[model samples]
Target: MISRASLRFSLGRFTTAEEIDAAAAKLVAVVTHLRQNAPAFEFD
Candidate 1:
């Protein structure tokens, strides 16, 4: 079976859409790097 994992993020204050998108982009980049460097790691 395959299990999915995720991260929970909370901001102390309100944030703009651009800020949220930037954060998500960073997370995707990190995940992509891990997928490239680590054979067993994968994310969607």
Candidate 2:
């Protein structure tokens, strides 16, 4: 699981793009990272 700390860390360094795309991109990256590294973890 990608902890809230990691998400906060990623968002903390960014100052722009606070709209939908930015959020979508971040979520996608998080999901991708988790999926790749934690295949046995249930996302549902």
Candidate 3:
């Protein structure tokens, strides 16, 4: 779902401050993109 919805954001390998910050930025970007572009996906 991450790959299908996000812009090639790779996760699960962050251990430094820069990497964590980048991950957070990527996450925000993904959520914003999905909110404005992708259809709403609700969990049941």
Candidate topping lDDT: 1
Which pairs of residues collide in candidate 1? none
Q: Which candidate would rank higher by lDDT, 1 or 3?
A: 1
Model 2, TM vs. native: 0.46
- Candidate 1 lDDT over 1-44, as tens digits, reads 33446888887667889898999999899987766776453332
TM-scores vs. true structure, each candidate: 0.58, 0.46, 0.53
Residue-by-residue lDDT tens digits, candidate 2, 1-44: 43433544344454566665777898899888877786454443
In model 3, which regions exceed 4 Å deviation? 1-14, 40-44
lDDT of 1 at 40: 55
Q: Determine the backbone clash count of candidate 2.
A: 0
Candidate with the larger lDDT of 1 and 2: 1
lDDT of each: 0.74, 0.64, 0.67
**lDDT at 26, model 2:** 84
In model 3, the clashing pairs are: none
